[model samples]
Target: MGEKQPNEQLATWFVRSGWSKGELARQVNRRARQIGASHISTDTSRVRRWLDGESPREPIPKILSDLFSERFGSLVTIEDLGLKAVPNLAPGSGVDLPWNGSQTVQLISDYSRSDLMLNRRGFLGTSLALTAGSALIEPMQRWLAPAPASGGLPTGALATARGGRPPTGRISPPELALLESTVRMFRQWDAQNGGGLRRKAVVGQLHEVCDLLQETYPADVTRRLFQTTAQLAHLAGWMSYDIGMHPSAQKYYVLALHAAKEAGDRPFGALILSDMCRQMIHLNRSSDALELVHLAQYGSRDTATARTSALMHALEARAYANLGEVNKCYRAARLAEDSFTDISVPLEQEPDWITFFSEAELNAENAHSYRDLSYHAGRSEVYALQAQPVMERAVELFAQDPDHQRSYALNLIGMSSVHLLQKQPEEAAASAQQALEIAIRIRSERVNTRVRKTTAAATDEFRGVAEVIELRDRVKQELPEYTRNQAV
Candidate 1:
């Protein structure tokens, strides 16, 4: 018989096995656990990867095949499972990498060691230019899709303190260092390059950190750690938005929001939701975005600091602008501005999470809102010019801080794109090149995509210019294969 086609054979097997994707994952995980592989967190994407001819790394394939064989009363080799060699899964592919359950556990166990290395001053350079493309963004987009409305709280709601121990009690100093270090690395990558490249690594790291924090830390520490992790996750999600990964980014943001809530940090939680709303606006789901912004504002009313409240209002203004609600946008923008009046006082007692939002940051946000409104009203020239200086200052102020990298990169990219639109090729190319350099250093797909878009736009303006052509070609060459595949 001829070799079975990939999709048909996989579909047939799925149908014949009387197993849903979730069931398969559960079975695989259960078997792996019985075999002492306790680190497995199997999900639908794992099954999807198998269907796509991607095999699990290490003993996972063997274990999974064995589990299936035992149940089916048939010999099921790795080949039968369509995994002879590990297929090159994309960044978000659900397949377990070389690390199986055991390895995962080991990695988490050794988190402290890694944390020490990561947190060392100036451990990683901050100049690598990363790229963000559709590949990164699409997954985030899917993840960020609006959750179905329900009366009760979500499944991942906070629970009472377990075992009469605090969630953060188990965290070692080294582990804390690791968390801070990773956050720093991600921030630097985001600022210099864009969110595209560093986002995946940040998310993965956040997940690992979250797992460790939950298992080992005491309550207060766990709460704080989770809040930080959630913030990183949300930033990753925002990068996902820049690269068009709406769904996956959405999921990360939602998860981050939940994490913030679990930390009893309502302000941070609201900030995350507001960030999600920003993504919704980018996706042109303006109405949905506005609703989310409102939800954030309402939820955060009690505890939100001036900076946080300003950010929420600014985000709401952006969404309103996107929807062409000029009056509403203006109102929100004015509120955002007013919120900033008290920013300095709050900064003295500011939480760690909102420390990045200073007066300059507030001004930048105001500029961003104006830019958005201007763009919507077809006054692009004025807004575009106004945005440039504000964003430039913002980037300059944030340059030294790794935590603000993603935001800086984003603003730079936006500023560069605007420059391109304004026919300022030299400025555009310079900004694009700087962003590209940052994107390369960071491991984010979304930042790369934004760079690509900026470069692509620049190409339109500088078609015959050698520098622009060279830059465009370089970006094209640097784009990840998966991104190129999606584009094709």
Candidate 2:
């Protein structure tokens, strides 16, 4: 065999991380454990081999990329690490490319079609690497520019025999309204039920809408059609995320952002970016999430209504709380509350999408932010104590709506975490049991994920307790294998 070439790129990132070889091995193993890959144990010698130019297997390159991305608060792909020969462990789904409005439609059609195919094939995990939120900053900046006027469309439904090919069919206002109504129905279902039951349905609907976009319409109708398309794409993205198809979710979100821009709905675009920020936070990239939210807030400052502003601030609080910034978290939470109180628009006047950010939703965001704060505050139980009343109020409000089971279930998990932070094992277990009961009824993988995380915490805290043991057993039986593996 010839002499081996050193992996300079890997060596550079390793030096930048300032972690010893052994520490790198430990972190790799820990990350593997989080993903239920219990078999991935490496020692310092393995790390040395990697640095000495031996290409690691399928997951190590991906895992190292993720680790370095989180460490550097930016994207670090496999190619950046000089491990391009290893099969890419993550999926992108073409979200990183720059595309025009027509290209955006194609992207949506391609992504949703593949999503349906994967679902039909009984695929559980998506073969996608999530695009980092930080990587979206420049694209969002471009989206902030003024949208071009929707001119040059046919004035009436009749297709003019110009030099170009005519549209497939004419889209009327009634058709646009029907599509809008369908989006509303899908939104309500997603809110009440998790994304699993109807995700495929949403994707199918999105495909239909994309096809409709090819039809002829007046400028006003065309704008509304794109608006409806944006809404459908955003819902599809959220459902994808809810079902744990995270890479697909990221792609759909990028598509939604593009559609929203084409529709000239700056506020809605900001909302989509905020939702993307929440996903980043879930992926343990709070710094990137914080930056993304700031971009959203800044970009929509003029166009965002009071309700949208409140929701954005609440999400900002969530990112801050996850980052352990106590003061910033509370400050953003207070801003959210204040924004809600200052709403000048009537409930009926606000957009259909922002209408859901009512007082109950704000309270839920605050409750979650406070619960996260409790964990980050170290030994202090003050934040934990503060979380209870907010959580109680949220639970009370959410309980009033029986259809809002997923929200209710999530708050229960939050409440349980607060109880755990306060050293109330019995209360924590009780709340967790309640959450699990609700979670099993819901079809949301996100709820199942919460159950897994909470159960893992309960197990760690009350290792020998009968109730916690039973909770773990129930989770194993109810949740999927991936979730069950992570719960341990």
Candidate 3:
């Protein structure tokens, strides 16, 4: 038989609806229940077949039609959803949305719907649902390319060519202040309370801000508006990452990148790139992370202030750490520290989003870089001991700030790892125990992840010690999957 035709139209609609095939299946079952019908095998597999152009028989076709119609907030038909064999319908195939306000609005709307409503996990082929339809990390030039003449944005907010003047219905100072304040609060909540608290509400707020940007504003206010929007997008991205939603997190980061570029805040754009580097490192794509660091460097260009420069090098140190390039990591670390010395007013003058980058963060990167280096060079007491003081200092700093509960907990775990490597099982257990206290109180899974690693280290090298064993048991109780990965 000849190959079956693919229905890109239905795929787009599926992405727009923010519904995964599995979600579609589940919704269909519920809608079926409303009609008092039972026994339908409307699983993801069946939905996949329909996407591949197999017609659904009779009632189910109409049922699917209704489901998508409600999701996209418009009429949909069996034909639209590929219930019948059909050709691609959405014009020439491409996922790139031209840089404009309406496109940006739709992007955020679809992303929010997918995240808040569908809570989608994997979207493999759809542009509307996943990165498949999104641009991968682009070069700095693409991001820093000339802004549109009209406010330098496709969604032109009439900017002042000379002295800044207010436009009618322009974004007021108070409104911009509120946006900045919201991002600040969200940042605090993310560090102290956990990203899970009202994250969906933040996404909702992003939509509101996105709507605000659609309107024209003064040149000065527009710049501030873009800056504010970028920060919120970054927050949305960070929260999504904290909860293990990698795809959604990446989308938010990309949106943040665009917003920063649109704002013409070169420093903020570099910051976004640095943030992306961190995410890439987490995903184990060190090479990609390195590229993002370079992009960040280029984005900063000549106008990079001392604080921004410090952050860039510090972020580079992290990527180097991931690559196990010890010498390069050290070089970057030194540059970061040196750059910090040049900053004026330091954290007080730095952007709120980046104000948290201090000695503690630098120390953490050092500890991680050295730990990774030791893995390849053969473990040494000297290596472990050196990392200890850095981690201890970091832990001290984070611990003093109660709102940074998760960071404090993870740093404690980092300290415990060094102690473990040095054969100080008692110290290791105590440090891990302290970390556990914070982990239990916070909602971050990442904090739990660190504790699990600490538990693994304790059990692997010092199984005979009672305190170590006790620590392991407690960790297992806290994270049920903690029992499965005991490998060193």
By TM-score, how accurate is candidate 2?
Answer: 0.80
lDDT of each: 0.59, 0.77, 0.68
Best by TM-score: 2
Q: In candidate 3, what are the lDDT values of residues 106-174, reduced to their tens digit?
A: 566566555554442222111222222014554334776676655454344543433344465555578
Query: Model 3: which ten-residue window has the lowest total lDDT?
Result: 124-133
Deviating ranges (above 4 Å) for candidate 2: 1-93, 122-125, 148-168, 482-488
Expressed as tens digits, the lDDT of each residue in 1-488 for candidate 1 is: 66434554545656778899999888767655543456767899977876765646655766555555434533344555565535434432221222122232333324323322432221111011111233323332332233233212121222223443333335677867777766866665555565545554775676576566545444455555666666776776666555544444564565565445445567777777777676656545677677777777777678787888888888887887777777887798789879887666645577655666665566566566666766676756766776677677766776656655655566677767667656788888887777777676654555665777678767876898777887888888876532311210
Report the candidate with higher TM-score, 1 versus 2. 2
What is the per-residue lDDT of model 2 for residues 1-488, given as tens digits with 9 covering 90 to 100?
78779989999999999999999999888766655466889999999999899988766777787678656645677788888634443343445545356667777877777666654532323345665544566666676665443232222221332323455667666877888999989888888877877777888999998887666554566567778878888888888778665666777888888888767788988989898888887777788789888989998998899899999999999999989998899899999999999999899998888877877789989988887777677735888888889898888888887867888898888888888888887788888889888887777877887888888888987988888888888888887543312210
**What's model 3's TM-score?**
0.74
- Residue 80 lDDT (model 3): 63
TM-score of candidate 1 relative to the true fold: 0.56
